[model samples]
Structure formats: structure tokens, C-alpha cells
Target: MKLSHALAALIIAWFAVFGRIQAVTLEVNQGNSTCIKAELTASFSITYNTSNSTRTVQVPLPDSATVDAGSSSCGLDGNTPWLVAVFGPGHALGLSFSTNGSLYSVANLTLQYNLSDTSVFPEANSSDVVTVVSSSVGIWAPINTTYRCLSSATFGVGGVTVTFSNMRLEAYMPGNDLSPAESVCMADQASTTAPPTTTTSATTTVTPAPTPPGTPERGVYSVNNTNGTACLLAQMGLQLNVSYFSQSQNKTIQELVNVTPNLTSSSGSCEASSATLILTEGRATTLTFTFTLNSTSNKYHLSALTLLANWSDMTAPLSASNTSLNYLRSTKGRSYMCNTEQTLAVVPSFSLNTFKLQVQPFEVTTNQFATAEECQMDQDQMLIPIIVGAALAGLVLIVLIAYLIGRKRSHAGYQTI
Candidate 1:
């Protein structure tokens, strides 16, 4: 047959150029240049081997990448492979070498565009090679594996636009040969609001009153003299005892008495015996006889008894005298009869009466018989010779008995002398 069909077409073109030179090496161990407004993921992994028979692999991404080609199994001679992918946004997926009659074979490539500036691959200009090569592989086999591109674009340019409200996103991949894939965009932390505070208070008071209680708040007889006799004889008669005598309240009544009499015979010839008279009633009183008799003993003895004696109420009856003879003569013509027996209480009891009287012989060169026997012996010593002839002998016997009865009636009319 035409040389066995030319050795089976040279063993099927060397088994499709040795399965595209032993393909299955797609490594963008991480890639994403731009293309994440929201949903985004990009990863790469493929290490190949399928010469002894088992194979089925495919891994390509960047259409705003996304992939979970985990749990894969592909073997031709074990060198583990078949981790496949192809995901969203202006894409470029790499690592290809198909076996089912081969047609896809590209070692590695990763490109993700469209940070949406109206898409169609925009927003990548910071050095602008943000990777771009989609599906036109084959230039001196320069697509040979190994890649790592991580880019998150939210960059603003001329038309400035950046917005992410309350956003947070963090990613880190550790296995399946994407050794460096990290992303973080977190912002959402807010809380605030304050103002309001106040307080105050005050008070005062006083009172008092009530008090009262308190109250306590009487005591005059006098008499004095040593004595010069303020005469006070009180038997209630002497003007009622001198009206209660208070001569400056005197007090010295040691019994007062003062009497003095003396007449020792002035004319006597042979008769003159009448001496025994004593009277004392200085201040002791029951008065009845306190002698008085003075008008010359009533013209020498006509005796109308001018109180010759009274010893306070004696029995009243006296008149007895039998004359004989005597020298006790003080006469007008011999008259000396004395009687006072009102039961006499001593005027010497009338000299114990042994009456003998009649001896009137008187001449002494007559001065009218010597003034009538010295006025009848001073009226028989009444009140002791008139308190001893005081008051000038009773005013000279009352002017000589009124001029001797007016000269005996003018000498009895010049004839009956």
C-alpha cells in the first residue's frame, strides 16, 4: 500500500508532534491584570504527562477569571495533570495541547482586561502591557508556560470614578502552584454621635418662738426725859390728870416733896402753945384733908371752917372744946378752940386735945396788937403756913385785911372805937 501509507503518516505526524512536545504546562501561578468591578478570580495550573494513555485536560482563563478545576486526573505516564479552566472578562487563557486528534496547544498565557471603561479591554495603562495576547499563539514557541499576574483595577484616570460603598474583599491562594495571589479592599467602619448633659438643686429653711414666766416683792413704834417733875398726879382730877401729862414724855417721879415753914413767936406774953402739926401727901392721894383755912382763920375764929382739914371722907361731926387756961395766945380776945373730928386722921389729932386756953394778954406797943397776932398764927398753919408764906405771905394778908376793914369803918364813924 504506498509504503504502508508512509509509515502511518509518520506515525501520525509523530503523534502530533509528540503531543505538542509533551504539553500540559500552563502556569500563571496567579493572574488578573484588570477586570474586577465585582466578581473576579483567576488561577493557573497544569503540569502534564499522558504517554501511556489517560488524558483529558484544559485550563484557560481571563474573562474576568474564575475557576475551580480541582480534583483532576490525567495520566499518560504519571506526572499528574489536568487542572482546567476558562473564565470571564476580556480573556486570555493559556496552556493547551489536546489529544483527540490534537489542535489546541499553547503553553501558558494570562490576560484579563476591562476595568469597565465601557469595556473592550480598557483601564490598564500604568505601564500598559497589562498583558494582552489572546489566542494567536506561535512565535518561536515563546508561549512556554510559567506566569503570575495579579491585578485589581479600580484606578481612576481622566474621568475619575472610584466607588466602593462599605466594601471588603480579601483573597489568598496557597496551593496548586499559584504561590502569590493576594487581594484586600476593605472599608466599612463607622459610628458617632454626642451632646447632652445637665443637673442642679437648692433649698433652705428656719423657725423659732415661745417663752415667759417670772414675779416676788412689806416692814415702823418710838418714847424719852430724866426728871424735873412734870407733875402728874392721876386720880383723874386735875383736869383729868393734866390731860395725860406728856411733857416730852418725862419719866422721873421719885416722889417729890418740898415744904418749909418757920414762925417762932412774934408776940407772946404768957400764952402760945400750939405746936404739933405735920402734913404729908406729897404724891399719895385719897384726898379728903389737905389743909386750907386762911382769911386770918376767919377773923380770929368765927370758924366757918374754911377747910382747915380733910383727910378724905371722915365721918363729919366735930365741935368740942372746954376752955381752961393757956398761954397759946394769938387772939382777937382770946380765941383758940380747935375741933376737927370727922374721925380725924391726924392733924396731930388736934394736939391730943387737953384744951386749956385763956391767956390773951398782948400789948407789945400795939401795931394793932401786933398785926392781930400775926394773923392768927398764920391761919393755924394750914397747908403748912401757906406753903411757907410764899406768894408774899398771901399778898400781905390780902392787903392787910382790906385796910383793917377800911379802918374799922372809919373808926366806927369816929366814935365806937
Candidate 2:
């Protein structure tokens, strides 16, 4: 028992030393006054190309990062104030702010990274350093109150994306304690421009897939086994619509937030009779899809679904799970396919849409989907086209018979005359 205790202590010490520590606050000074005081937490998703393939890496802002007071400056002449946090060689986090009336917002975020640095990118191959910039983060706060958002918000420029959450920021305030947040970030406050859709022909227009109420992007996700064989595959757009009581804002509200894919923050496990896909959308939301196979029936189905949402308004994150699901069933080797969009109300606080979805949980041979089992929605959609075609055929037959009878009557009338 003594030996075991000593070993446990050593393990604890090792973890303390190796575990990543997150910084709580950052202060930038200009001349004799504090320019900015931000308590921020963010994670970056960067897509970079290596010598052989393209990969995405997620890295959090480390605690060791420090403000660059020498290069940072306060706002002047209607220009925004900016702050820079330098972490390591050739890597930094930069932010610029915008002010309107009594509110202030983050206008731009610039991320500089070095691909050759193994400390930042574990799969570094080349020595190229690049900067990715995102604009209009939509975080706003009143001048008297610090801007705080517990919900995660995502924005991206090209291949670089940032998910900002749990932030408390005050700009141009000196020698004052941070006040409570009265106004938080909301999607309606941000500027959004929809892209124009292209068509194959003048008569053929393709409709884009529907995303969740507040989410913007969708993706296809896959989980592989140890031998590099795919064990589970899914394609869908997800969003979490939930209601919570905000203690700081003193109100109860509902938020519909998008669930974006974080490839670097996801994991999966596969067994002979079961498979699980665990996907994360940032630091705040997690989605778990569990599937099981039944050999006796030669079929597989989604057996359970779990969603965890961490909202700042609540004391603890809400966990919504449904284990009684028998949805998305298919043959053991076939995939469940549905082209129509659907909303799944798993629970009151847990609802999402699986848009343009196709999933195969087990027996994914050749890294491709086999024959598919059409979902109820797809089967129902197929009947609409068939019904329309049959109705048109019947209308044409009636028109032809009417014309023939009119001609026969005219001929009989002429011969009798």
C-alpha cells in the first residue's frame, strides 16, 4: 500500500508539471495607464498543407503568452486600439477593437503561426510562417460593463478559424475593477452576407442545405480504427437549441447555436458490436453518437445520442441524452441515406437537424459506403415525383379521348348532311 501511494503521488506530480495551464487575465499598458484588460479564452483551428497531405490543428492560447506593450497602442483619431500577445517565436495573437456610442467590440483578430515549429504544429513539415485574420467577432459590451460571453462563437477567414468563449474584456479603462456584463454577444448583432448560388442551367437550380438557426457551416465526419479502416462515417449540419437562465444578465433566454466540427478535438472507438462517434464543437459543446450492431438481424442502428452544452448563464453545463432511439437503421453493411432535412427533438433542451445526412456506423468496407437504405423521408419524397408523373399521364389520356370524340361527331354530322 505504501508503494502504491508513492507511485500515485509521483503520477500526480507529473501531471501537474505537464498539464497545460490557461491564463485568466491579460493587461496591456500604454504610457502611464492601462490600455486593455482582457480575460479571454480561445481555441484556433488552422488548416495547413504538409508535404503529403492537408491537416487541421487546434491550439489554445497558452498561459505563458504575454502582452507586447512596446508595440501595442491605444486608440487615436477614430482608429481602433490594438493589443498583441506573443507566445513563442513567430507566433502571436492580436486583437483590434471598435467602439460605437457606449459599446465596444472586437473588430479583427490576427493569428501568426510557424508551421516548422513542432511545439505549435505537431505535424510540422515546412518552415513557412503564415498569418490568418478574422473580422467582426461580434463581441460587444457597454463602456461601464465588461463584455462577457460564456457561449462560444466561431468566425473564420479562409482556412483559419477561431472559437472565442468565456471572455471578459474592458478597453480604455484605467484603475477600475471589471464590472458585471450587461450585454453579451448575439448572432443578430453580427453582419452576415449570403453568398450567391450558382446553377447548372437556367431551368435547374440547386438548393443549399439548411443549417441550424445560428450555425453557418456543415461537414462530413469519419472515425477510423487502429488499422486505418473507417469504422463510422456521418454527414450532417448540427445546431443546439436550448434555454437557460442567466444569472449575470438576470433573465431567461433561448439560444440556437451552431455546432461546427472540430476535427482536432474529436475521437472515436469501434468494437465488434458497437461504435461511437464523439465530436466537439469548441470548448463548450459536445455531441456523441452511439450505434450498435445486431448480428442476428444483420442490421445496425443508432442506439443513443448525447449532447452537452455549457452556457455561461447556468451554473453547470446541461447534459441531454436519449438512449431509447432506434433511428437510422440499415443493413449491416449498407448506409442509411436521407436527402431531406429533418429535425430531431431528442429532448426539450436538446433538438437539432440532420441535414442531407448519410451515416454508416459499422462494416465500412473499402472505405466507401455500400448499398443504401432509404430513410422514411427519402422514401416519402420519392412518391411525390411518381404521383405527379402518374397524374400528368392521366390528364393527357383524357385530353386525347376528348379530341377523338369531337372529330367523330363532326364526321358523322357531315356525312348525314
Candidate 3:
């Protein structure tokens, strides 16, 4: 019995140390539109480059990865969330979590990234891809990739699988994720500006600057929220950098720092069951949102909206002149507006609400996820193999003990004969 116990213990220890871990399956939903929803297991890693004063987050499938685990919604697996990010602290906090496909070679700070599933409120899960439009700049652990500009930015590569031709490159500054004035450069841009005297007949060649460390992005954005009264608005400063990345050290960069008429204005209110924000800035502005869900389409729609807004930046260190800039712009004359309309959809889903937004309009959405610490090992997972090994070891020990005793008796019988 003692020998059996000893053998069992050895087997238990062997499997515990050497057993292989397997991948767990997750659900993927693409719905009818191209907006993708899928799940995959990912290991979170953070590294800080003391040399460059930057932090690097590498969350791609590990080097040991064999395949993308494959999802049916899209043919192959490894569908990185439309965005990948990691949030940390300081002016560099939010930029730490950005669109480098989990390789955050920008920003300097500790890291954390979370977003609630749009459909489900607080129920969260780890995902391969996350969506965002903000970023930082600095060289990371190892820089790679060549720079290339998209032929066009408006029709960004969007689908289940993300490829060079079918993917998008966006950049933003640290602060609010959905600031109307916060520029998010997702489109291909003209390579260079021509002087009026040097005008040409053909179109301007379109090539981006580069996407290395990264570039700041500026512009406007709005999202319909599941919580009707939670919606808010923001007008950011003009003159921001943008980035476009594909692979390795090469990247495309640009800037909209010269925002025409740089400053603008806005005002926001949340009452009854709805929240409204009137902005006169950047490219697109004017937002009227519903506080309830659409009965026909499980999505929320903007009951009233227009494209107008003041251009301002909230992340700039507050100074006497800047602190009250937004307020001054809001009280401007003519209710400033432009002709072109924005086509972006403000699909109602999950949203972040805060007291700070009660007076202003800037917020973010986060993910809900099963954390690494919370994962439990099922008895059936590795225990089955462990137990089988123990039983085999114990049986061998019993047979060996029996054999020794029998041999001793045979030797004693020979001596008696």
C-alpha cells in the first residue's frame, strides 16, 4: 500500500508539470452587417522600454501559435477585434491602448483595457480585437514593417478577415475615445499639398506620411448609446497627428493640425429620456439622440442630427485661455454649419456614463471579460489524464511487489529441497 501511494504521487506530479494546455472555444457573431463580433483567448503582456520612455503591449497570438483557431463567421480565425488596445495612466494613459493590432509601440504608462459587449450590458469577455481611435508616439521593443498608403481611406478594408488591402489604420490623441473634435484618421489622404500656382490637371497623389511610433489623429465622432440619457458631446482642438500601419517598421503618418478656423463651440443637455448636444466644429456636428431602443431594429437611432461643431481639444493642459475656450465658442453667432453631411452610423449599444459628462460630452465603451485569475481548471480537463497516469503507476508497483515476494518464496523452496 505504501509503495502504491508513492507511485501514485510520482505520476500525479509528472502530469502536473508536463501536461499540455489546450485552447478554449468562444462564440462569434457577425450579424448581418460587416461589423464583426467574435471571441478568442489571449494572453496579456506588458513591457516598458526604459531606453525610449515608452511601454509596449504585445497581445498577438503567441509565437507558438499554429493557426487562427478559425471562426466560421469569417473563414479563418485570428480575427483581431476591429481594434486592439491597452489603457494605462497620465496624458499618456488612454493612448497606451490603441490600434497597433495589440502591439502598442506608443505611450508611456501602466496598462489596462476593457470594453463591455455592445449588446450585453456588463457581461464581458476577453477578445482578440478592440476598437478605438486614439494613440501615442515612441519606438518600442523592436520596430518592423514598411510604410504604404491606402489608395483610398473612405472605403477602409472591413470584413471578417483583416488583411493589408482590407484593413484600416487609425490614430488618435489620449483623452476621450469618442470626442467629436477628437480626430480619428481612418481614410487614405493626399500625399502632399500643391501651391495654388502649381495646380495640376490630374488628381493629387495619395500616400500617407508613416505609421511608426505613431501619429495623433483628430476629427469628429458620435455613438448612439444603449443608455439614452447617458450620451454626451465633445469638441476637440484642431491640428492633430494621424497614423497608418500595415506591417513591420514601415508606417504611414499624417496630420490635420491646420484645422480651418481652428476653434469652435458646443453645448449639451440630458433630460427626460433623451440627451442632446449641439456642436459647431470640425467636419461633422449636431447630434440629437433617443434615450430608448428602436422597436423595429434592435439598434438605437439618432432622432435628430446635423453636421456642425466647434473644433477644440480637451486633453491640452488647461490654461486661462484654453479652460474657457469651449464655453466662448458655444455662444457664437449664425449657428455655424457646413454643407457636407456625415454618413457614420451611431448604432445604439453599450456606453459609458459619468458625472463629468453631465456638463460636457465625452465618454468611452469598455469590454467585459472573464479574467485570467477567475478561470478555473475543470476536474475533467487535466485531472482525467492525471488520474489515469496515477492508476497505471500504482498497478505497476503492485505487480512488482508481488513478483518480488514470489521470487523470495521460490528461492526459499529451493533451499529447503
Candidate 4:
């Protein structure tokens, strides 16, 4: 019985080690300084074929994979930089980086694989090379801070599906490892069940049914002062509307897009009397909000907003600025809440819906959201029904008086009718 138990225990331990997906840590450097250091878990779903059947395979990035950041590794201080990781003989992953002023992000993903490697793809009769490319993965952050997305983000391109999770990366920093206080995580990056696409023959193609989009990406974004006192807190679904010139249509076009958490980089900071939140969409768009505290009123309000959008077709970027808006007013110790679904239009190009939104800015005590002040719009909505009820009561009173007077007149001496 003891020997049998030992065998079983060893079997269980082996499975425990091999069952989990492998994670890899990578670092890219520019000469003596580290440009990017990341630890991520990756999984791939690949489709291949044999003489008589089409089969699918699921593979994880191996633990032996290593990033190449040697003498021929990086673009250094160029406008665009890049890095690569070789997992096997012919399997590799590549990333291209882009910088915009003070921010940088991974702009593209390139994955290459070979079918002749039976270790990755079993029972593959033919040798074929597959390459998958995707753009605008949109993992970005400010310089020196780490970019993180612990939730899984899946990307599908052509016949390949890749899922990356538990990712942490810092780019263009002089330091060796990640920083603690400045790390920013991309919010609401929940993974989706991506279906696989396959091919039966050279000319024919079979595509998987596309998954419906999931819930709107929303997160509790906050900022704290240097001394660790909370100062700004916001929760809302952010959206942007912009008008641009379409070169193909030869006309102007207006479009509305969600400021998705997965594709947008967000950051916040606070001072003694002011706070700001910055959101950027890769290198093409940026939105900023500034809030100020009024000590006399003991309230804080959104004081200014700015937006800059750059598209390749336009000769110049679109810019908009507004000041003294005095929006989202709340006491220093309270937050603003609007339970009803209402959209607050900050400018013609920017708006947000207050669905399950409670926000406080400029002062936060005890590290907790204080009492919530109902929005003025919700207050007005509540008053509408009360006003209608009062009007109906008045009309009923008038009708009752008229009926009583008519009865009294008819009963006088019993013959007036």
C-alpha cells in the first residue's frame, strides 16, 4: 500500500507541474540600459491539416524561449523600436513599439510558426510556414512606469488565435525592473471565447463564428496624493465622437467610438488642490481632464478638458479645449452618484454615460468613498412625478367642489331640478 501511494503521489505531482501553461520572462535592452522587461503567459490555437483530416492544436509558449536583445537587437532611440523572442527552431514572437511624445506602446504583434516541427503540431504531413500579424494591440503607458494587464486579452488574426495574460512590461526606462507606484494596469481586459478558423483545402476556407462583443469596459480610476491620501475617483463609460475628413469618400465623416479600456492607456495624478486624468489611444488620440477644488465652497468640479486627435488622412490634428465647465460638483468628503442612465456631454466631441457611476475628486478621506450626493439631473427627474401628482390632486379638488355645489342646489326646496 505504501509503494502504490508513492507512485500515485508522483503521478499527481508530474501532472500538476505540466498541466499549467508556461510563462516566460523577457527583457530587451538598448546597449547598457533595459528598454523593456516583461513577464507574460501566452497560449496559441493553431489549425493544420494532414492527407485525410484537418486537426487543431493548442500550444503554450515554452519555458525555454528567450528574448534576443543583443548587439543587433533594438532600434535604440529611433522613432519605432522592436524586439523578438525565439521559442523554438522556427517559432518566434515579435513586437513593434511606437512612441508619441512622452508615451510609448506595443503597436503590433507578429507571430511565426512552422508546421514541420512535430513537437508543436503533431501528425502534420506537410511542411508549411504560417505567419500572423495584428495591429493596434494598444498596450501603452508613460515612460518609466510599467504597463500591466493581469486579465487575459485574446487576439485573432487570419487563422491564428493568441491569448496573453498576466502581462507586465516597462519600456524605455533606465531602470532594470518595474516600478511599484507608477505601474498602470489596463482595465476590463477580460478574455473572450475565441473560436478557431480552419482550412480544409488550399483554395477553400472555413471561418469560425465571430464572438459577440462583451460588456462595456469600465473601471474605478483613482488618483492619490504623494502622501497616500486619495484625491480623485471616477467610474464611468467614456466615449468619444469626432469628425474627420475621409480621403476615400472625399467628404467629412463623423464617428463615435468607445474609449475602451483594453485599447486605451489611462493615468491619473493629484496635487493639493487639483487633479488630472489622461487617456490616450495609441499615438493618434489623447483626452485630458483637469479638476480644481474650491475651498470656500468645500467642493470640487471639473474645470477644464482637452482633446487631440491625429489621423493619417488629415493634414493637421483635431484639437478642442474647454474651460470652466464646472461639471460633476461634489463636496470634499462626498461623491457624485447618478443611478439613472444619463449621458453628460462635456464637449461636442466627448461624452460619458453615468451608469453605476460614483465619482469624487480633489479630496478623499479614509481611503473610502464617502456619502454620495445624488446628481442634479436625477433630482429633477424625481421632482417631475411629484409635480404631476400635485396637479392631478388640485383638479380633483375642483371637481369635488363643483359636484357638492350642484347637489346642494338641487336639494334646495326639493323642486329646483
Candidate 5:
């Protein structure tokens, strides 16, 4: 009867141990304020005080979700908990706890899970409540529940959180930094126009001045002696009839011909009787004459003379004699010498026939004389002077002859007394 009681106690203890191992719980929290729809993950740890038996745990997951176990030896250590890796779409997680233990021994069990699958959450919403339950404890537990999208989880400053919509995350890895957004529009531009151009021109002008007038004119001529005729004598007077653009006019030109006499008898004498010529009106023209006398040949000829006269038919002849117009036989008994002179005159109506007078053999000589008009002006020049001794001798002879006649008359008176 005591063995029976012991066996019954062991069977009751085995059932109680099994019940404790089957208790499990799960919970979730999506920590947000906006509306969100997303999945949740629950991880579990199981603790059991049992011996000689194995327990198995099952954790329910959402459709299309997965479950995986962490290393089994992790559950053996009291501090190392078991892990249930969960993946799913709902806001709740599922966990199952199981263990192996002996009968009639008091056994205690604890369950632990890893809530790692966070991708099932709706990325746009807020946090919501999550519940956990255990059949062995007959209780529902509340945990602070939060949901996270795995793709949107960010790790910062010792914790992890879901990145919100419209919030940009810029991360700096080892190589390059993140870039910022750019701007859109631009500003306006500026404008201008040039001023109008101008042009100008200038002109200049000039002019000039005037002038004046000038003087008058004149002429010249010469006379020459040629042929055997004597040269026109120096101081010989002549008559020229000249006309220039007018009626003919007459003018007296002085004869420059002369003779010098040498007498052998005290009573013998020679004189200049005539040396002149007159021109007739129609017969006075251009002619020239050379008056030279050759006593040895007894020939008297006139040199060809050119006269500046108005008429072409003018002619004249030159003559010389011992008396006024007659030849004297007694003048031949005395020796006579002759010479010539040259003269010039310019009259308004006169012309000159010859321009020069050339006397050849240069030694043939001539003498110059004053004109007959010049000679008549001074009579003292015409008279010859007597010597003082000759005058005294004549006076003495007259006085002596007068005194002898007076003495003869006085002696005849004394004889009568």
C-alpha cells in the first residue's frame, strides 16, 4: 500500500512539470504617433529546471514569415537565454516553450525569445499596443510595444529607431560625404544703346594783287675817214639837214678845217680866205666829205662823206681859198700847212651818218679850232701881239728923225740973222 502511494505522487509531479515547460509569451511595440500598419517580431528565451527529458518550443509566425533558433547550448547556461528569431507582418509575435524533465520532481521553466524581424511594419504609421500570453500562467501581459520597418531602421547614439517619412538620412561612410539638394531659377540681365554720331566740314579761300609800267628809247652813230682824202678835220664846222618824222630843217655846223702858213719874204703873207659850204633844200642829204689838200700833187679831193639827211638827192661840196671865194696866184709863193678837227651835234630832227672816225697810220695829225661864232666873241684873241723891243726901236727912230728936221730949220734961221 505505501508503494502504490509513491508511484501516484510521481505521476502527478510529471504532469505539473510538463505544464510549466509549455508556457510561452510574446509582445511588440511600434513607437510612433502617426498611423502605421506593419509586422512584428518576437524572440523568446526558455528556462527549465528539469532532468533526463528534452523539450521542444514552437513559435507561431505570420504568413510569409520565418523562424530560426539561436545556438542550442545558449539555453544551458542560466545567464545565456534561448533565442527565437521571428519574421512576419502582424503587430504581434508568437512563442512556444517546451522542455524534458523527470516525474515527481518539482520543475521550473522560463522562456525567452529574440524579436528581430521588424520588416512587417507599415512604414507610414504610429506606435500601437502589443500583448503576450502564457497558458500555464493563465494571464495576458502588456509590454511597451513598438513596430519598426527593417529597411527604415537607423542606429544612432546607443539606440535604434525607425526613420520617419520625409526625413532624409545622410550618412558618412569611410570614403565620400553626402550631397545636398540644388536650386532652380536665375536672375535677369542688363541692357543699353549707343549715342548718335556727328560730322562737320570747313572751307577756306584766297585772292591776289596787280602791277605797273616802264621807260623810253634812243640811238647813236659814227664818222670815219678813208681813201686818199684827208680825214674830216678836228674842229671843222659842218652843216647838217636832218629830219625825223617831220619836215626838213637846216642847221649850221662849223668848219674844223684850217691852214697854217710859212712866209720867206717880210711882205709875203697867207690867210684863211674861205672854208664853208651851204646845203640846198632838195640837194641836202646823207653825204660825207674829207677836206685834205696835197700841195705836192696840186690835187684837192673830198673823201666820201655820209650825211644823215632827209632827202636822198642832197649833195654838197667843201672849198678853201686864199681870198673869200677866189684863188690867189700870190698865195702859191708861200708855204701853207693844213689840219682838221672833229665835232658832234645832236638835234631833235637830226641824224648821224657815220658812227666812228678811224684815222690810219695813227701819226697823221690834225688840229682843233674854235668855231667862227666863238672867235668873233673875243677880239683880243684875233689880234696878234708885237714884241716890246721892236716897239721901242720904232719909237726911237721917229723921235730922232723929228729932231734932225727941227735942227735944219733952226740953222737956216741963224744964217739969215
Candidate 6:
């Protein structure tokens, strides 16, 4: 009887161990039945905040067996097309189909990433590689970076978020801290998703993303697309501003641009973005616009999208009688530079809803604002002369008082010199 009882206990223990082993196998690759390659989808894009370097990552389908369906707006990183810049594992990428549309889905995921693992990425352990994963980008600089991924990225903090995974992650350097255009590298094994462009035939009607409160519904946007690689010369004030709606986010943003750019006469900072432009003349320059659209008939309404730079100039203020238009005409050797490009109304009526600009805020080289510390320093600098003058006055007053006391003592003394 004792032997039979012992034998039965041993059998029960063996069964419990076997069951545990089966459960462990189910959790492999996040419970993926079969590992499948990742693909790029329209729902993928990258956006960076100039204010903060907090990157919100959503990529890499956990399971190749199950794929999600969705789309996102992705094109034009400022002037350069997104496909040309955002590529590979370093930048944020979007993946679509999984294992050629298998019956699997990434039910849940717990991404364990060391936010600040900045050891040179893609552990290419090929003897000459280093990676640095950084949590706080304040310290790490994504130097000599290249943007490459399988799919394109949208502009202006795009709204489309995909459920699947696989793609790249870009560097997050705040406010030109480290090469505004540079991209941060991603570590290997982390970038398990490859660049594969595959899509489903399902048609998705995407609704516009929410807009900020008080955003204008319509207007022509000015942007800085033409200031290719030109450092901003000076800053001027803009009295007039133009605006456009971003289809990705359905929000209106300010920008500067000309239907037909007269680069010679455009002064200050004439750069373009999808949504905003800076036609700053570093000095106050009154921008005037006039256009003659040759419609088949004479049914054309002429309007002007005049942009007046509103910022103060480092140099002398624009003349109260503003001779900027006259100056541009003389310098560019062109007549009618002041002929009023458009009438008082916008050149293209908002009703037409054509002619909009794009804004790759990350790619914007100009329109930069001074930091708090920098502004404080400027204040200190301006007060320096005043401080020196006050010190001199105090010294002179002390000297004067001393002289008066000395003269009084001499006058009172019996012996004089």
C-alpha cells in the first residue's frame, strides 16, 4: 500500500512540471505562432516637438501572424520629401501587413526599452561600431545622423497611430540643442522590423485630426521653403500674416511663400515651410504682394497676401516712411516692385481652397526664438553701459564731497599752504 501511494505522488509532480513547460513556450516572441517579417504602411509617420524631445513610439508588429489596418498622412519633411529623409531603423517607421495577412494580431505589448541607451545603435558589433541609447536627450547628440526607413513620415505632429509595429525612431534634440536636422540612431535587436512596403487593398477614408481651438478654417499659408541652406541674415517684423490648414491635423498654421518667388527682391528671412514662412528682413520691411491670374475670362478677383515681419530688427527700425519696397526694386533691378502684387484681398480666395503650404517644423532652419537664458543675457548686455555710468557718477559725487570738506578744513586752519 505504501509503494502504490508513493508512485501516484511521483506521477502528479511530473504532470505539473510538463504543464509549466507548455505555458512558457506560448509566450515566445510575445506568443507569436510563427515569426513574420514587418511591412511599411500608410499609417506610419514621424513628428518631433521643438519644445520637448519626448518621442512617442508606435511601431513593430509584435506578431507577424496578425496585422492591423489603418493609414496616416506622410509626405514632405519641409521641402524634402519624407521618403528621401525618414528611412531605416533610426527614424520612427510604420508597419502594416504581417506574414502576408495571417490570422494573428498583437493583442498586447510591453516594450522594455532603456530610454537612454545611447551606445551608437544597431550593435553592428562589427568591431568599429558604438551605440548610445539616451532617455534624456539633453545630454546625447545624434551627430552625423542619416534618416532612413521603409515608409514616409507625416508633418506637424501627425495624428495617425497604427496598431501594428515595426519601423525606425529618430533622435529627439530639443530646440537646436544638437543639429536640428540630425537623427538619432537605434540599437540592434530593438529594430527587428525590416523595411518592407506592403499594403492591403482596403480603402480607408481618414477623417481630419482635431485642430486647436480658434484655428482659422481657411487662408493662404506663408512658409520658408526656398531659403535652401541659407543662414538667416537678419530679423524683421511682420505686420501681415498668412495662414493655411494642415490636412493631416486639419489645423491652420502661419507660413510665408510666393506663387512665383522673386528671390532677388525677397529680403530679411525668406524661407518656406508647408504651413509657415518667414519673410523676415532682419529689419522692419513692409512686404507687399500683387498678382494677375490669367483666368480664361476677366472674372479674376485680385487680392494681396501681404506679410509684414512683426519682430524688431537688430538694425535700425524700418523707416516710418518704409522705403523697403523702393529699395528692393532698385537692388533687384526690376520695375513695378511696388506695383502692389495683389489688391487688398488675398491673391487666391479662400473659397478656391487651393495653393496651401507644408510645414516640416523639424526641418525649419530659421524662425528660431531666443531661449530664456539668452534673452536674459541680452537684457544684461543692454544694461551694462547704464551700470558703468552710474558707477562713475557715484565716484564723482564722493570726490566732490571730499573736496568740499578739505576746503572747509583748510579755511578753518590757522596755517595755510
How much lDDT does candidate 1 score?
A: 0.24
Candidate 4 Cα errors over 4 Å, as ranges: 1-20, 70-72, 77-79, 186-417
State the lDDT of candidate 1 residue by residue for 253-350, as single tens digits. 11111111121111101112111111112221111111111235522221110011111222211111111112233444332322211111122122
Of the two candidates 2 and 3, the one with more favorable TM-score, higher being better, is 2
For candidate 3, lDDT tens digit of each residue in 1-417?
999996577555433432332332222224332222212233333332333364433232222222121322221255333222221211001112122232212221222333232121122333223432211111111112211223321111111111122222222212212122312112222333423455689896665554443222233423335554334433322322222332332233222232322343444454433335433333322222222223344322233322212223321111000000011111111111111121222211111111111122222223211111111123244567999999999999999999999999988876532
Clashes of each: 25, 0, 54, 0, 66, 80
Per-residue lDDT of candidate 6, residues 212-262 (tens digit): 332222222233336354322222221223343334433334444222223
| TM-score-based ranking | 2, 4, 6, 3, 5, 1
TM-score pick, better of 2 and 6: 2
State, as a TM-score between 0 and 1, how close model 6 is to the true structure.
0.24
| TM-score for predicted model 2 compared with the true structure | 0.48
Q: For model 5, what is the C-alpha lDDT against the true structure?
A: 0.24
**Model 2: per-residue Cα lDDT over 1-417, one tens digit each:** 999996577555534432454645787776667768888777788877776888786767767678887656687676569888876667788888765444455655788888876655555577888886544334555556666666666655435777777777887674545765445443321222334655564674444434546543567888999998888887777666666555654344566776666442556777787777777665555577778778899888876676655555663345555555677888888899887777777666567677677888888888887788999888988999999999999999999999999999988876542
Instruction: Please identify which of the two predictions, 5 or 6, would achieve the higher TM-score against the true structure.
Output: 6
TM-score of 3: 0.20
lDDT of each residue in 1-417, candidate 5, tens digit only: 899996577545434422222212221111222111123332232211223443322332323333243321123344322223243323223223212111000011122232322222212133333333221110101111121112211111101111211111111111122123311000000011223535446552322221211111111111223443322222222333243221121222322111111110011111122111211123222122222234664433322122322222212121111111111111211221222222233322332222112222111233221122221212333332445566788999999999999999988886442
**Which structure among the candidates has the greatest TM-score?**
2
TM-score, predicted candidate 1 vs. hidden true structure: 0.13
Angstrom error at residue 38, model 6 = 7.1
How accurate locally, in lDDT, is each candidate?
A: 0.24, 0.69, 0.28, 0.67, 0.24, 0.26
Give me the candidate number with maximum lDDT.
2
Q: Which one wins by lDDT: 1 or 5?
A: 5
